[model samples]
Target: MFGLILDVTARIHYALRGLMPTNVLLDALHTRRGLKWGVPAMLLAVPYALAAVFCTSQVEAGGSGWFNLLALIFAWNALKFLVAGPLTLMRLLWVLGREANARRRAARALLGEGFGPELVEEPVLTSRRA
Candidate 1:
């Protein structure tokens, strides 16, 4: 039972690590970097949400099918800003708050103590222009 729980937890942690933005996650974990990138992203989202609301009002007045499609796009953008974006950030914080395998791996890498399989470098691309 204990082993099963550990396995599940490790998998969950691994998934969370993959979801995380590497630099941001490492900065947040190692130092106490707060809202450096997150604040800018949220600030940008605000105007988009407001624009969506304005478009919604305009679309209602028009009562045209084509405009409805535009309204749908506006609504999607608004929902991403007002709902999904914040929820994602909240989830990230929640995941980061706990002790996980990701944190261990990060710490190990930072301390130059890695002991897994070596990473392979990406191949260089050469462009030929005629």
Candidate 2:
């Protein structure tokens, strides 16, 4: 788990960390604005979903408010993920330290039994622009 996490960090840092001083990228993921946008987005989604379901009409002549509401909510939810979700997940990664850690832990648990972890290194490329 640690190795995978470290490897990801190594890759990001060694690659083009375009954000200013670069070290700033290592800081927490939960930017104030990111949380601000993310929370309301998630909160609004629930009621919108329920409202959509309730407003719709049944099979036959389904042109009811419920159907429209459902469509609206679905669209809203899709938009939310398109914008808000990544921010929240990025915040999660920020708080948790690294995404690779979460994936590694989940992978280990799924594998069960006694299968040890292994290190797989990738070669770094160099350009001779000189």
Candidate 3:
């Protein structure tokens, strides 16, 4: 039945989630603080890409057919890293903007309770003009 197939697929998916190293790394990278490392993580794609190229070259030179699988895996990982970088950077910027907006709202709330409208409406002059 379709229900049995769905149950089996779900179980396999969960099983693989625990076994995959990339999933663990991705979980860590999804955190707010971890977002800052995304740009730097793109550098990791270079080694993976190089490995893929090497594997492909070996296969072309009459190496084992299994090298093609390795090449495919490396290429996939390289693509993931390359894409994660910009996506993470964009997420980081969004998080920072949200935090800034929250801070500004809090400041306005506090200022409105204790200060006059003039103070809230006008910019505070740090220096007096003669």
**RMSD of model 3, in Å?**
7.4
Q: Model-by-model lDDT, in order?
A: 0.54, 0.52, 0.85
Native-vs-model 2 lDDT? 0.52
The model with the greatest lDDT is 3
**Residue 1 in candidate 3, Cα distance off native in Å:** 2.2
Using TM-score as the measure, the top candidate is 3
Q: At residue 68, give the lDDT of candidate 1.
A: 63
Task: Provide the lowest-lDDT 10-residue window in model 1.
Answer: 119-128
The regions of model 1 sitting more than 4 angstroms off are: 1-40, 60-64, 99-130
Candidate 1: residue pairs that collide: none
Poorly placed runs, candidate 3 (over 4 Å) = 115-130
Which candidate, 1 or 3, has the higher lDDT?
3
Model 2 TM-score relative to the real fold: 0.30
- Candidate 1: tens digits of C-alpha lDDT, residues 1-130: 9999999999998877666553244345333344334434545456656666666777778755666666666666545444433555665676677646566655565445333333212222333352
